[model samples]
Target chain A: MKNQLTVILAILLFFGTAGFSFAVKPGEQLSDPKLEQRARTISKGLRCVVCQNQSIDDSDAELAGDMRKLVRERILAGDSDQQVKDFMVERYGNFVLMKPPLAVNTLGLWLSPVLFILIGVGLFWHVSRRKPQTKKPIDTDETEHRLEEVLNKMKKN
Target chain B: MKIQPIKFLPVIILLGIGIAFAFGLRNDPSKLASTMINKPWPDFTLERVIADQPAFSREDLHGKISLVNVFGSWCAACVQEHPMLMRLANREGVIIYGIDWRDTAEAGSAWLEKYGNPYRKVGLDANSRLAIDLGVTGAPETFLVDKNAQIRFKVVGPIDEKIWTEQLKPMIQLLQNET
Candidate 1:
């Protein structure tokens, strides 16, 4: 029981510190909750380029904090959600958008998996169809007659 | 025997993957693309680093090719690039505008005093609002603005001799010619 209690305490401590490590700097909030919500939604879709994988909303990097504040400011200034995204893109390029739009640059990235799956399915179908022909048995009578003739020739020898 | 095209499919796929990896390896993920290139410099109004100095705005950046350098006392890289900036200010004809990003006014003023102030006008970006508009990821990023107030080039890291001579100087000449 004492060992189990120690394990539980260790788990709790680990998680507690983990949570602290990722704690993002709180951005200035707008009084209008609706606008704030829109800001957050936009933030969630924008990538923190410095952090690479994390969105600005979840990243603790100073740049991410600045970006989050910018999002809020834009929303408060009455820019629409699309405008906010466009503003970020204009400053940081398409890479700043967590969900990159389907465009010429992203066409291959978005479609390659589907293309690969189709190719894989086609190969599988082709291989499955060829299996029966390769595995088909020779004529039983011909095989037996050939064996007999060979045996007879062996006896003559 | 005729070679079937189907037999070459694996090879083609492998070649495709190899080409993709080659391009991928060539890309540096850490080098963030500046989307502000060729766009007009973002408008901003910021106080000067010195208490008594006049505030600076976007208007100050126009009418000449200027180097707007984002810096801070807290940034170690800014120190590394300071001498080069001082040299440029002394030797070059272009104006160097400074944006003190995310730094205290006191620290920024002191840093300039100690390291030597190279800027024609220094703006204090205490809140970093203008820094975001300029797409500054961190301290020590520099943007070269043409006479029309358009951002022509952005350098992410500390500028040394090589960058100034090879990249920046040529661009400055081109912009100068356009004027």
Candidate 2:
């Protein structure tokens, strides 16, 4: 019974993790492991034209499959990673890249996080400066005297 | 109570975000700006899709203003746009060249025969190699090439009467007048 349960759990786990596997079919894989790895890396960086959000490596679209093949073809042809990316950009524009290059058009997008953090820090400083301290220092002697009076009253009661 | 301008900041931010979303919702995400605009046609030598029709090459586009239409026999949208293309070819006398994208030559030739062939010449792009170079995302995409072979404009979807009368016809005339 335990063995059967383990087998079932293992099957479930395999099916659960299957969606995260690379979309590269066995036939599409290169003969050389090194070239295949390079192809995968390049595919992960390119956005599928038909399915805009998913990378070519993750997309099941026909265009994505074709793009993956093209990536491997370019690599086999001795084109460098940058050259492959440039080749895609020449046809599909910079939109084909998963992460767009930092250029004049993308300056605002690249700098926005730093801009937001600086704004937050400036707000923190300004608010802290404007806040008046409300906490008063306690006088130990007065507290002790009040405590003594309270003790005497309690004793009389 | 005197209204403090700072107190309305939430409302202002809400209004800004609402406006931004309204504009974003109006725009279609699938439509991308053409990268081939103002660039010369990419080089390709393609075989004739049909035995009777003439074959087309990149060099053929250089001497005339013409429309390069990417289509596939399997695509339903291509069928839907076939009538408009026929009208344009017959009535407007627009020179149209076809790229039968990602389809078998037999299928493409049959499709052209079934729907009245509107193309002056049809190129068979069985592997979609030429289509990819042309940056074709889907079938039935059309490009307006000037006399110099520079791609002037691209229409993503099927061109209707409005697009033809308002945009493409005027552009064609303008290009023809250019000395």
lDDT of 2 by residue, A1-157 (tens): 9999999999999998977688899999999999999999999999998989999999988778888888999999999999999999999999999999999998978998897688568767766787687887998999999999999999999
| TM-scores of all predicted structures | 0.83, 0.84
Best by TM-score: 2
Q: When superposed on Cα atoms, how far off is each prediction in RMSD? A: 4.5, 7.7
* Tens digits of lDDT, candidate 2, B1-179: 99976556558868977998999899887788889899888888887888876788888797799999999899899898999999999998999999998788899999998999999889998766787788888878999999999999999988888989899999999999975
Q: What TM-score does candidate 1 reach? A: 0.83
Candidate 1 ranges with C-alpha deviation above 4 Å: A1-27, A31-33, A133-157, B1-12
Query: Could you tally the backbone clashes for each prediction?
Result: 0, 0
User: Which residue pairs in model 2 clash with each other?
Assistant: none
lDDT by residue (B1-179, candidate 1, tens digit) is 99989999999999999999999999878778888899999888897788888756788887899999999999999999999999999987658989998888899999999999899888899877888787777779999999999999999989999999999999998888997
- Candidate 2 accuracy as lDDT: 0.89
**The CA-based lDDT of model 1 is what?**
0.87
Write down the TM-score for model 2. 0.84
